[model samples]
Target: MKKIFIVFVGLCLLIQSRAIADEGMWLPSLIHKLNIGEMQKMGLELSADEIYSINNSSLKDAIVALDRGSCTGELISSEGLILTNHHCGFDEIQTHSSVDHDYLQDGFWAKTKEEELPNPGKTVSFLVRVENVTDQIVADLTDEMPFAERNASIQRKSFEIQKEATEDTHYDARVQSLLEGNRYYLFVYETFRDVRLVGAPPKSIGKFGGDTDNWMWPRHTGDFSLFRVYCGPDGKPASYSEDNIPFQPRHHLPISLKGYDKDDFAMVMGYPGSTNRYKSSFGIDYTMNETNEARINARAKKLEIMKRYMGSSQKARIQYASKHARSSNYYKYSIGQNKGLSALQVIEKKKNIEQEFATWANASEERKAKYGKALELIESAYENTQDESAYEYLVETMVRGPEIFYFSYGAKGLYEALKQDNQERVKTNAEQLKTELDDFFKDYNANTDAKVAAALMEVFNNNVTPPYQPRFFNEIKYKYKGDFDAYVQKMFDKTLFAHRAELEEFLNNPKLKTLEKDRAFQSALDIFDLMSVLGSKMRETKADLLTGRRLFVAGMMEMYNDKKFYPDANSTMRLTYGTVGDYIPRDGVHYSYFTTLKGYIEKEIPGDDEFDVPGKLKELYEAKDYGQYADADGTLHTCFTTNNDITGGNSGSPVINGNGELIGVAFDGNWEAMSGDIAFEPELQKCINVDIRFVLWTIDKFAGATNLIDEMTIVK
Candidate 1:
């Protein structure tokens, strides 16, 4: 019976490995080759050409890349009204917020086009076309050529291809590799810089379930925001201007107030950030033991300090909301990922796969010559990098964790100009530095940073070996007698950058000697130098590992000719299809696919930070005025789950139904499948999304933004 059970599990694994109709993150341009028939069979109402067509308007025309590629947004109206996740627009909301007009606490809505708030640096890009350019890029390269020479040849050819693709056009072009550099495609994009915030729900509604409920199932977060794209009078991309008009998009999604049913076909199209689906067991073990451990520990300390300070004052809360959210989101994700990876036994599965691959490789001399040493290379790489734990900890704490380092590092160019004795260069750098410092100091809290620095520095000093310690750390240990708190206090009190006024004045009257004498600047330089050395060491040691993994992936593709192989995500737009579904996470625990407003109200704890229900929303719920957003049973759905594959940058991707109508906005993933990026768990993985009707209800009833609602093409 035990042997039978084992065999059954192996069979299940084999079945799962063959990309199911809904399992792969497929290239949209290759849908015909990989997924069109299956998608049509699964109930796709639109043809492949209707989904993606370079010569004509299609669903692809409506989707836009938010802030380059961090998130995605879909056009809801021809007037360029875009719908995306609230957290995707969190930074912009925070930028427009302040103590007096706290847009983050209270929502903002533009009653008219003139009232829309312009975002300076925010931009969105539309995919113009994708062309197969593999032959062009690697035509001259051979397998026997030196790896470095071959890489250089590919890069040089890619540069020429991108240049030709974008020549005499306003489009931006990039060459993306697929199948571990076995294929390449040139993608052209039209970018618009004039994006404006049209509307957003208050934090009480938009971020209702805060960190406590992030990435959890049965979610009730609204998780949606509204923006509009603007362009010049001729409908061409342009910089932000008062004279700019609302962009008339080629196509816009028709949102369906009709919610989905179980096993109903759903599709997601967006730029997913990354995945390591082909990672070896050695890499998995390293991530489990060192990478995740370092991130979890360092972020936990920083988040604790930020929360303490944020809890004390509303101003602090406003200033740190974006920062805190960014830190805590991944802190919790890292924790969940470690748990999921262990619970799913991913490393053990990887080892089994590796063993199978080894056996396959040894069956023939040609296979042995190509793939025999791959696993050894991977194992040697991880084993030789045991010190990466300490290195990563230092990076998290001293380099990235502390804002002081960032501020000082931002002025390195200015320091170099001063050293060069070039007055013109110094003057130019001074203005740039001043502008940068103004932006930095706006959201920065000195007291909070000082506390964080002291805590994180102590953690670094206590854990890192002497040789791995940064110079500033050693000074704290030997000179200050391990009194990190004292060192931090003194540094914060004396650093010119700590006082914006003093920093501005110093920028105005720049001096090389005075700058060099600045302790904070000196500390930043030393830490950056050490980080450079450590990064170089890591790159050098991991070179063979990278090559080996690439070869291994290609070898697997060759060996499994019957199975479809999709490349891991690299922040390129792709499509994933699945269904609205439920799952049993564990025995006797069948989770539902949807959550309603009633569950939301039940989860509310009045006066609690994470689960506070807005008074207006509560009143609307109490009065049973869900408008057109409620079902026949009078319950308004807040969120739902689908099996569509997603990752970090896929946030705000439109969850379209069979008829190519928007039903929800994809936001989070289930905690049970946090390991999906490393190894997809078919039964457990689910994409959590805010129902479109809930989003519309929030805009129409709770916020009374009828003008904004009037702009959308609601398919009721």
Candidate 2:
């Protein structure tokens, strides 16, 4: 009876706190229908006026919006200090980490601004607000308009609205239309054209168990990184300026000096990538069944291949971390998602929905008009381009593309075309970039080239491309009588012009490089050249297939405006609202809203790379003096869970409350939702975030950067 009462009371508190979190802003249908001031019921204790005042005043100017060269971020300080998740900044930061100074392994910290790392081509964009123009947008699109024309019309309308909304505003902004032709939202933004790194934990600490712990339960990793935003001489936005000044945001979050307890009212505001809880069953099935299995299987194989080269070469390690990071990410996320699909019964649910939709529509003419032809439409699409489309991704991503694909959607052809397009747009940049290419090639990977080639050869032989009778293959055959390993080796490095040294050394080695110098590598380079052509074909087909399917769904979905879709999770700015609470992930298996400092200690296998705690964190826990925010567990926990909706692109979102106070920084979600690309399991899935309190604790206790903490109002 007593336990029941406690749970009942706890439920009430959770409801109240969730209400209090959104003190003023209107709640989207996703979070608990919360209004701005509703969070007080959840133990916020503060009145709506107080919360609104805080949102409108406190830190309003303190939190400067940050763009991680792409996504949005908030400046958490007055001195150009920035805060974002470790994953968001990993790419640029990784470029600077190496064997001698492996920051990813240990994490990066700058004692002062001068020591902060500089990353070229990175940016931070600040958002102002978003407005809806749905009715106006829909009225203009005629049924007669061609798909191309309709899209143009929508773009013009959206662009105009964006221009007007951001007119004369110092910040940058854009308008994105969601659900094809159904709705539109204009986002006003403040862009800091040049952003630089401030600090970051080592990869061990930032990424912790690397990909092993990503999006899992009972996770104990700190996936956070730090950076600073910069602008031009006149305190304006500019691109890559040495003469830039540290940008000071209008409002910065006052690091909560008074920590949080279990039911604190909170919310997160940042661009969330995407959530497909509302997708069709066919979409769900393809992902949960075929796509998931195929992708995970391929990734597992690719990892084995990558390990071979990465272990053998340091240069290979450096060049491929980005690719490794991407594949590892997919591998981890996919497996987790596969687990989620089963656990959440995503496949069954998809089948059920498909059946239900059909049964519901069989009797009604209106219903039939609405979606009765799903099977016919779907089958036609599959027949029209399945093989060609599959080949597109294969050609673009796996074959004729860099095995070490970076920023190439598994398609090197498309990447090159885009690269060319960008280069053409900047002729001067093309000239300057020519100078950078030599250095890029000098640092290019022999091992990576081999690995990618091997992967490509595997794809070509196994799939679309035929087994060719190239000399590279013959070299392997001659060397090892057709042993696959020997074959792989020859294909990887069997240069026709075997000139390891200069041309003079290989005198009659009429092998290609015999008479030529470094030109011996030309055979491989020549094939690399054809990448653009292959990429172009792949791009067109991929667009025709992926886009066609997506657009059809979007077109079908144009009628369902009750829910709003943000976009394809393009790593942009977004906001997710939820309260602080925990739930039972499975039967009788409860997950606390918060974990503790002691939890970290218990998990630490002292010196075990996966569980090693930083000295500062160890000291704090050893002291056992958690300030106001420590949970009943007696440990200061950095991570927490919530019921807020999210997906891959939401990796670094900031979780906030009704008053818009950031309670946590978003990173990953529970694996059960990995099918989230198509299904949503509200009961079992939760978003994992780095608590705001942890961010504060790191700044004050560990990093010893107290200057940032003192800048915020430490509310109790």
Candidate 3:
């Protein structure tokens, strides 16, 4: 049975591999020559060798590299140029842009090589390929090993593999687990340390419709950016150097000129964060739908308050910039998930999954016994944490949240992170504060005092000892005559407005040595110190909460379900593939992959600030310069749709053909896929890709990046 299971998984992997290999749609080639012939027969312009040749692994590098959260660029040029999304590179560009060079407001341009702007410390990564280590991992995680012990064993193995593979090479690799505890793979990646900002379109052109139009179809946003990766003299990763050369690639995608028609197969090759296809009806139905609403609402309130302050005060804007982005991300996902749940008819799906479980579990005495333990474990965790865990969770959240506004994983695995952990995360007390709060002031933002104070106070009151005392209580008392509110208010009214200089002043002040001595602050800092090593403690606590419940919910699903179930998300890489298709959201509403320029103009109202499309794009629309691009909207005659499995990290993934030519970048998934976290609806699930033609026209006519566009096979 196990052999059959392994073979089944392998066959599925082979099918997918062949779907991409040499661009054959369905048939498997018997030889390399046959494969090449089949690829060309299927309009697969690029060969398997060509595809593999361009898959260089030297993109992830920089002096201070951004974490996985940021959409990274891939070098398409040997002359040191890269391509990424506009939003991903916005901050660095904004930092260098000014009133005279207002890249943020009007966008930027560099007609010649000398015109490109150098970003002091930006990097890009290229993934070479992946290999399996399931045998080694499964052997190490034998039945006698506990989950923690199993995880540790895997980690040790991963380090060994990474060191071996990356030695004598300026590259990095890591081990990854798949199918919960079923499979494992190792990915090898090469990074380019020196990357520079090239050009961006103005907000008017780039972010035209802004947040309101986000996630909506038939959109007209020029969402693209240009960058270049540079390598040092010895042909290796290095810090920014004037003499650095543009990286040469083993393979580079030639841009496709004739855009895709409907029903064309497309695949996204990149990292995807998580998917909850294996979640129980219990969590997806009861917990996620109900609990996520409250969590989302709480964050919505925080965002509203922060936005109000940000709109009025520049100091507040800069200080809480990270906070707003973090909160907004939650807001976006929450709202999208809610929409997906509604679209999926979650309440109904919940009933269906439950009915199936009750029938299967009660089928026989043997069935009931089989599911009992798994069910019990999940119920226990829910009972313990449903109400009481939020406080501690919030404290833990506070310690990690702000630090990861722009960073993914909140910068886990830092040098001092593990040294500060408590032996056990059993009791929520001074130990948590000491380990988690140790780094609080080290990276604290002084501006946006109201929000920071409010967040801390909430965490303190809900999770800390005896509840209800501000951080740095003693310091505020000594510094401002015993009024925490007054001290916060003083910080808000006086200190925050002059944010940058004032923060330095507060940290450096001799009299306010109180910064380090503050009791509440110290407590929070201690917890920060221990956050890394406490993963096991937290995971154990978590296991106790959900999947551990064998007798309650998880058991029945595990024992009797038709498909094998994996646990809920733990930030792992997963691959979900399906057909290229569209979905009907309601009785009438539909979406498409290609949204025409004419359709965007049709939706526009004259004299409206937001509705205005640049005159040039409008002219191109009037002339119907689509080349071969088609309108996706059947009813509105505007846009098109596709089905490519994607999520957060897939935002900037390049959508490619069997020939390995760039089609369009995968940006957003449709509403159906939003339910993807809890339920992988193969029927309705689809991904939204911005067609390559829209990108081509924007570059050639709009941004006049004609030279860059000319590098590709623009068939026209």
TM-score for every candidate vs. truth?
0.97, 0.76, 0.73
Clashes of 1: 0
Look at candidate 1 and tell me the lDDT of residue 713. Answer: 86
Best by lDDT: 1
Give me the runs in candidate 1 sitting further than 4 Å from their true place: 1-19
Give the winner by lDDT: 1 or 3: 1
Q: What is the C-alpha RMSD of each candidate to the true structure, in Å?
A: 2.1, 7.6, 8.5
User: 151-246, model 2: which lDDT tens digit per residue?
Assistant: 677788877777777777675666665543345666565666677777777655677666667777666667777888877877778887667788
Model 1: per-residue lDDT, tens digit, 1-716?
A: 56434422432222123245567788788887777888888889899989999888999999989988899999999899999999999999999998898998888888888989999989999999899999898789876776678888989999999999999999999998876677899989999999999999998888988998899988999998999999999999999999899999889999898788999999999999888887888898888878888888888999999999899888889889999999988889989999999998888877877777788899999999988887887788887764687778878787779789878878888899989888899999889987787579888988889898898887777677888877777788789998989998998877887789888889889999877878788888988887787887887766678768877877777776676778788888889998999999989999999999999999989988888888988899999899989965678999999999899999999999999999999999999999988887788899999999999999999988898878788887
- The candidates, ranked best first by lDDT, are 1, 2, 3
Task: Please report how far candidate 3 places residue 243 from its true position, in Å.
Answer: 1.2
lDDT, candidate 2, at 257: 37
For candidate 1, the 10 contiguous residues with the lowest summed lDDT are: 7-16
Which pairs clash (backbone N, Cα, C closer than 3 Å) in model 1? Answer: none
Off by over 4 Å in 3: 1-69, 72-75, 78-80, 285-291, 309-326, 342-372, 386-487, 490-499, 502-512, 516-537, 543-580, 605-612, 615-640
